[model samples]
Target chain A: MISLDIDKPRAGARVVVAMSGGVDSAVTAALVAEAGYDAVGVTLQLYDDGAASARKGACCAGQDIYDARRVADALGIPHYVLDYRTRFRESVMEPFAEAYVAGETPIPCVACNRTVKFRDLLGLARDLGADALATGHYVRRLPGPDGPELHRAVDADRDQSYFLFATSRDQLDYLRFPLGGMTKDAVRREAERRALPVAAKPDSQDICFVPNGGYARAVERLRPGAAEPGDIVDLDGRRLGGHDGTIAFTVGQRRGLKVGGTGEPLYVIRTEPEARRVVVGPRAALARSEIALGGLNWLAGAEPPCRPTPVQARIRSARPPAPATLHASADGTATVALDTPEHGVAPGQACVLYDGERVLGGGWIRRAVRP
Target chain B: MSARVYLDYNASAPVWPEAADAVDEAMRAGANASSIHAPGRAARARIEDARESVARLVGADPAGIVFTGGGTEANNQAIRCSGAERVLVSAIEHESVLSADEKAEILPVDPEGVVDPEALDRALAGDARSALVAVMLANNETGVIQPVARVAEIARRRGARVHCDAVQAAGKIPVDAASLGADSYALSAHKIGGPQGVGALVLRDPDAAGRLIHGGGQERGRRAGTENVAGVVGFGRAAGIVGERLEEFARLSALRDAMEAELHAVDPEAWTVGDRAPRLPNTSMTVMPGCESAAQVIAMDLDGIAVSAGSACSSGRIRLPYVLEAMGVDEAAAMCALRVSLGWWTTPDEIDRFVASWADLRRRTARRVA
Candidate 1:
């Protein structure tokens, strides 16, 4: 467990805090300032979608940037809004669409962190001649002999290490997570204690660029001709019905199928992009024992053992990490065998590996295998 | 600080040394301008002298200059005083004019943001009673000078008064109220090289029935309350200095043209707004397609040069440039509008620095897409 020395102040060190116009980031910046660092708040203008960002409460967009500027003004620190819309489109939005088209569910938050938040922002911090890049993420960084080590937050319910497995060692060295040692309640309490304007603001649930939770609609807007009508089929290759597009369907989605009752609830089992078809079955067919992972970024410097290394794997962000054994291949891919069968293992979903609270790494799920 | 390049002069300019000195001199006085004592008369003399200087700058009688807190208050007072059952304004006027009320009719601008005198003629010709024609002398976004004379003639023929928000035009160009035929003209101090918190409303006739702020008799009771003595002194000094530096502004205009040429060479799609119409000498608004203005501003800021997306007042909130959109530019092109304004303090080296920094930013941003 990592412990924070709250009483000791780290004086004179220049830290760049990423203020996203939320209570957590605001409190984190206030704490950093209170801790006696030369804190400079930076907000990234991720997109110029005009009213969409304001309506969705997206960080570093439209009105949120104003809130960040106000917080910085109140704190008497220099604030800046860095534009990252191009990077966001290339890194996060494109990959999200490609993943959906590949018949897998994708987690854009990981891509945002890896591309925009960490890489480009860290480069900006370096340009500003700051010592470290700080954020309000609910994850901790402990100073190790070799470098800073990443761990989950003190609040297990709010631990975000799973989404941060793609962070590189270089990025981690210049990173500081100010809210790591505090629970969500404690952070909120401190925000209230400091009288931050966003103390009671609700956390954002939907992806920032995708307004109204319409990811398929956003993709359609971005790529107008790609979303074509396709066929819905069963595992036995029997045609069921017509689908709008394979990208609109993900594993385990039930609603919007438009298929009448088969007396049993149908769940999406798989999607085939080549055939432009979605395969559905009963609830029993959704269970999977093994998942193939790709695009693996290992944060621990070396790959895990090939002979089913025992670890805890979190298939989704909200779910708890279940016991699993990961088998690494000679290629940069791994097969995770859950100790207990897990349901709704989507192909594009991320499989994050953790040892207790420390994040080992994670990769995108390529395919789920039945026992 | 690597020879600081200031391109956001439209936001708030550096106080001219003459203005700063005048402000310092005015603050040393020991009496309020409103008192009946000798010291008060001395302060009053200073206030009247500043008023004359401001009137001379805008070609108005000294009696017409009614001082207010600043440009915003000046605009608010002028726009609210149109005393009409219905208010009509150009679509490209500043937010101070646009945010008045729902009853205010926003007159549309053509593709070049030129308010069609015929349109105003039609609107005024239709509404005979209680109609106020409000159009800015120059747009804050594109710096395109409107045909206020034509608008005023058209309004007068229909028995309506014209109010021109000339805050962006007053010191940048040759502003003569008599020639423009505007009933009321608004001027702010800080848009030029003067102090903030002081401005003036030049009325065609001081006896016009309108009082935005009522208090202790000040500005001949047209605007009430104590005068911002130091700020007024600074404004007067700035107006006098700008009168002398008008030629310098022309020189800056040439530099602005050069900058535009370089930018267009880099991207032929780069277009300037109101290039065909009359505009402020030192103002140029360029549209860089597929590039966000806020991003360019940020990139320029990181490079230690200051620029803006449109107006600095609304920079933090990303919004479409309403003026450009009104001019028939699509929303996508409007988002890419970047306003780079030069001032008396802008040096040729500073312009060169901006060009180099912009080139670097363009290359770096281009790489990200590739």
Candidate 2:
């Protein structure tokens, strides 16, 4: 039986806390320091922007590092700024742009957490001789029969397990999520209790790379000639109108269609980048009963059941995980059949599966099929 | 390591032997310069002698120089003293200047970071009655020297005082306070082989009253508290050495030229900031397309070379150089710029090592991207 001690841990257990200059991470670092861990805060310098650096609310770049350093100084811990621009661009931004150009709605936060935060940052922590790598991600880890099992946060509203399903078991071993048990409000309260500088700092909503909420613009910047003008076609293959680029539209999107329909709202069912066309249809056509996933990574020791294994799958981060049956293939692919058809299941999105609260790993949705 | 090639001179250079010796001598004296006794008088003489040396190096009257903790403090003191209700500063000014006032208007620069004199004149001519103009003599990022004299003349005609943060320019160039004709000038000792914590702010008028630190009567009642005697002595010694070796050290300009040419050869689109403008001979700010400055700095460090992205004071903070932004370079390209500044200790072998390291880094970066 595991001992549960509510008291704060003793001080001076060397740990490296990844402080992203956000309220969550700032509070995490402060709590770790208060708990008697020799917490050394590190902020990844991911990009350069002179004007943006001087401006408020720009983190993960120059000014953010300064803010992190300031917080570290206030907390009386050693702070370091690591330059992870190349790694972040390759592992997060580049892939995000490429996926969009390939007619998919890519979620960059998953890639960032997987590659840059987990892999590269963990390697740095090891080099620094840190015992553990801590972040402010709201996910819990509990000792299970096999090893440490990843669990959903107690605060269901802010649980980030969906974005972190790709984290390997080995990576999880060295990781610590300090804000797992607390609600967002509690975290904010703790931040205020510690008198942390970013106590009421607003949460970052848009993609970090696409700072201006223009993911399409970021794609166009990366691949200048890739997003050519395309056609907005109906499900019957009739070109209804023209679109500047098929890359701008995502699966199940309803905005910017500019296609006049018979009063009923038309939604995007598909985006064909190769043909530069967006296929629009009725909202009912957006529902998908089954989704094929590729590049599957199962957090469990073995592959999920070759036959249907009952689980809960969430196609996107915001959506709740719906009851589904996951069928694993021999070649590391999986098919997830939802009990109730879900809407707007897009390719290139992560299909994270959960068994109760335990994250069972996930994969990118390759294709969504209607019943 | 092969002598640890020190390309981070802009961060802080090694204390010149003379400066170190002076510091040691002052430390040995063990007397407070403020005391009225004989020992105090002796210490006071040493402090004054050092002050004279520092003043001479920057072509300012000794009485006009007020020693401070360092460049940052000096910049803050000088900029905050401009006594203007509204401050007009070049976008490329150091963080000290940039953060002095949130409401300060930032004057734009061209692609080469040359501040348009007409733009300054127009800004000063506006409704800002108590506006103070602040522009650095040389940008810490690109080493791109601004047309301070032109800007100063414009500010003077408009009855505005000009403050130049000459920390990067003092030792690297022939800095004459009288020539620039700015109301106040800021310089850091460490940027010129002096002690890390000692710097001086020179006011064109000795009686210009603006005090950031208010306490005891020191620095001619302009600044407060006791002086850092050892550090001030080191600054004096370094300043004297810099003044004597000005012409000889200017030869580092050739090394900078060679490095710029080699970098451009490797990537034709790779740009050197202020290439056409007059700049510090030892500074090179190069932008390689698709290469991040922070990554290149890391790669250089792995190769046993120490370089900086822009100003070491603001190195880890990822931001485009304000100078570049004012020049209208897009944010993406600006983010990829790396600044390599040479110093008195730099040798040809080190420059060659840098070239080879950069070439290897380019190949590795390309491979990784592919």
TM-score of chain A of each: 0.91, 0.93
Off by over 4 Å in 1: A1-17, A21-40, A44-77, A81-134, A138-158, A165-311, A316-320, A325-337, A341-351, A354-371, B314-318
Per residue, candidate 1 scores C-alpha lDDT tens digits across A1-371 of: 22233223455466789988888889878887877787889888776666754543332346688888888887877787766677899999888887777777888888999889998787666545467788999998886565577888899988888789888888887788889888999888987877787778887667887877997897787777657788888779778788888878888889878776478888898888888889998888999889899888777655556676888999988778899988887677998899988888998788998888878777888888888
User: Model 2 Cα displacement at B210 (Å)?
Assistant: 1.9
Give residue A300's error in model 2 in angstroms.
13
Candidate 2 clashing pairs? Answer: A11-A36, A12-A36, A49-B319, A49-B320, A50-B320, A62-B317, A62-B318, B110-B327
TM-score attained by model 1: 0.71
Native contact share for candidate 1: 0.03
Superposition error at A227 for model 1 (Å): 27
- Off by more than 4 A, model 2: A1-111, A114-371, B126-130, B313-315
Worst 10 residues of 2 chain B by lDDT: B312-321
How many pairs of residues in model 2 come into backbone collision?
A: 8
Per lDDT, the best of the predicted structures is: 2
